[model samples]
Target: MLILKKLSMAMYMDQEDINIKFEKMGKIRTALVGYGSVGEKMHAPLITVCPDLELVAVVERRQEKSKEKYPEVSIFRSLEALLEADAADLIVIVTPNEFHFSQAKMALEAGKHVVVDKPVTIHSREAKELKQIAEEKGLVLSVFQNRRWDGDIRTIQKILAEGLLGRVVHFESHFDRFRPGLADNWREQDVPGNGITYDLGTHLIDQAVMLFGRPDWVYAEIFKQRTGAVADDFFDITLMFGSIKARLTASVLSKAPMPKFLVLGEKGSYIKYGLDVQEKAFKAGELPEGANWGLEDAQAWGELHLEHTSMTYETERGDYRIFYKNIADAISQKHTLRVPIDQAITVLEIIEAAFLSHQEGKRIPFKK
Candidate 1:
């Protein structure tokens, strides 16, 4: 597959073989619902990599910024305007958490394929509503659970898949930083779905679900770890999956951040540090198809332990753009979307349940 050339999974690539796979899929027309950090820094750059996808219009209130950054692209001041313009076949919602449900609902209702950023929606009810609406519309409704594209985590997943870690017993995933000072950003403001729990915690929790499916119960402590923080900043979410337990954590007070992922199984363990380079690459204006896109830096390789042997394993470079590419392919070629709305709803359920658990000071039962 063309993905093989760009993404290596225990195989060496020969150019002729790669091109044959690339010819099978066609390109798609895409629209951006928000022109914020995610739209400009991450999504825009990655869109360039997929030969089958075009970045048609960007929805934003600030026309000047949109015009300045994407001069050749159509700029709409609102979702209403964008939909009226009928600029593209797909709408990607990178808007704030509170707007996700309504915006995604409108896009799907309008017969446009939709992809919302993480957290899916403020609540599971909203997610379920969107899922039903999208199903009725026969449109692809997906969430951008982008961290699964992280190189370290993907490598960890590969290890687990290969039985290198045997049967995983304990897994820890963290997204922490020392952002003691709050930003004027909407994420720090008092808003539903605007907190570390929905922001960083969603990625970790969604990943846990992706690897292990939904848990039977969840125990979480969601609180504001930073002084004067309006929203939650610290959370220790525990997922109980019968025989195994997974801990997904995030903190604003962490000065020295810990490993990105730590997985322990019956046979061995895997420890990884540092976030993937794809985000940095996207921010630095590298295309998703850039040379050596997800290739890991030697210095940032992870460590693996098996039996009495300890070895350093270079993390597979994560390509967040893959999520968009897959979504585009799914839209055009009838391939199954990577992060479906149902999966997104499950993520929201976990998040809401975690919050309820924290509020009630008890474990929350998982509800299908």
Candidate 2:
């Protein structure tokens, strides 16, 4: 009788272990808010490809557009409906710049982990409050600074880490495009946090901050160059780090070709042209899997001009899908968040300072 009782207990323990393992491997139900370009093109597809995540629902205000591509995914009329129905374990906010803060706050308060698109929020204080809420609730909060995974950016990071740049004296990054006419969109309109600075500026600034920590002072000139442009269409911002200068600029009227990145160091210089291949692929409706997904062609490689010789340096593979994968791991496997809320707050602080610098026509001292 004693032997039989011990056997029963061992079997029960084994069953419990199996159950725990299965729970850990279960998929996180993800709901995407806003089915705009970012949602429909990037986030939705990436979420679907992540093995540990299931694209369960989406919040579409007007039309049921998501149904065409994601027929199985339920469509919520609004964020409130999705929250009330408890339709998702993770909520991804890909809405306009204005809605990021309020939507993220609502999701966190409703006990759902949140992933907000770039800029996190319009203000640093709002981002901090969201961070506090997530911490108090013991939930994961992240911003989709996807450009950090860009091939060119990653290559720059690798070069910096390998000490190829020696003591970097200057870093210049650009996101210029030739759009002489303004589009009838929220980003071009007179809306809060609506401008090229908030759109492209966020990515460049985030990349700079990731490569080098905070800057000492910021000087900027933000203006509108396009015809009938109410929002800012051009920005040339400089981040001063002691002797090192980082200049980030973007303009819609830039018709001439400009190097995407230019880094000058004591030893040599690295100049790269062309944006990451992942954005074009995503826009082309390509899935984020397969071996050749993020690979950059050798023809598009950057040039490393040294004192005597210049060579083409291959760019690192750009993998934006890793962002979603990291989110899944953070939620299910207890991995640390790659793009934490605090980092997003820091980016917003820099942005605020840049605007101040442009407004007051003086270099603003950096402050936490």
Candidate 3:
């Protein structure tokens, strides 16, 4: 047993060689799972652009699709085969929400670091189990809460840091869209983790939790607004913390322009509209190289209103690639995980609470 422990420690130390000497370090070989829209457009490009990471392999069930863009990468039909081949040091699971738990468990048990797309798992308990496995194996585990680096959120962080928003009191965030009809997508299907509450709600909830810790309680009203919709299309969740309240809402029927973020504080308010530019660039298949990759146009800037005057506050450049860089650093033992599994689990807990709140028609106290 001691011999096996020694071998595991030695292997870990060898992989995290930067901890001993930066000159001997090598790029972390990363494997991507599910070459779907997000995997192809966002994860692959971000991984390729990071200096400390390499896109080495991908798991695709059907045709060799990833080869068109990443020809150098090895393609496997199943994650079991990839693990058998010992192809990569890191596994990125960008598969659908239901597959996240099983795939992440397999990778972690195989002693590979993992990054799961947001919401982590279908249930918070499943996420807790994955966290235990990763901790027992001394592996790096994180969720892809990439929106934490969105331009507007980054700008809000800066504003708070500079005391420009003086003790924020209310934060209202909206993620409305015009898709009144359901697309034939898995997210809108009758699945274990389907609905806007788990889709956009994950991002919105994570952002609120990241900014204001856990809420004291959750009160939500969730519904399937569109006809013939199996999954929920609308939600208005409110998280209360002492004198502050964070309201997060989303719907598929909203057509008119709505405020992306409306923040009120003791001093004044900050109102912002328009989504971050990185997702648009990524969906358009733009490579994440060069300095200007995430810069928001001045026209999309938000407004900060004080008692006497209101001014345009420049939106900070949003960089999704930073998430990959942080992952690399965390693997090298140079930095702590930015979106730790614990945060993701907390997001899941809040989600569960919100659902319960809706079902019971009462404000539910958030479980720690």
If both were scored by lDDT, which would come out higher, candidate 1 or candidate 3? 3
Q: lDDT per residue, candidate 1, 307-343, as tens digits? A: 9999999787687877877887676544688888777
For candidate 2, which ten residues in a row score worst on lDDT?
13-22
Off by over 4 Å in 1: 1-26
Alpha-carbon RMSD, each predicted model: 8.6, 5.0, 2.3
Error of 1 at 349 (Å): 0.5
Stronger candidate by TM-score (2 vs 3): 3
Residue-wise C-alpha lDDT for candidate 3, range 18-111, written one tens digit per residue: 4765335488889999999999999999999899999999999998999999899999999999999999999999998999999999999999
* Colliding pairs, model 1: 27-52, 28-52, 294-317
User: Per-residue alpha-carbon lDDT of model 2 for 200-307, expressed as tens digits?
Assistant: 999999998898888998999999887788999999999987788999999988889999999999989999999999999999999899999899999999999888
Q: How many backbone clashes does every candidate have?
A: 3, 0, 0
Off by over 4 Å in 3: 1-18, 21-25
The estimated TM-scores of all candidates read 0.90, 0.93, 0.95
For residue 316, model 1's alpha carbon misses the true position, in angstroms, by 1.5
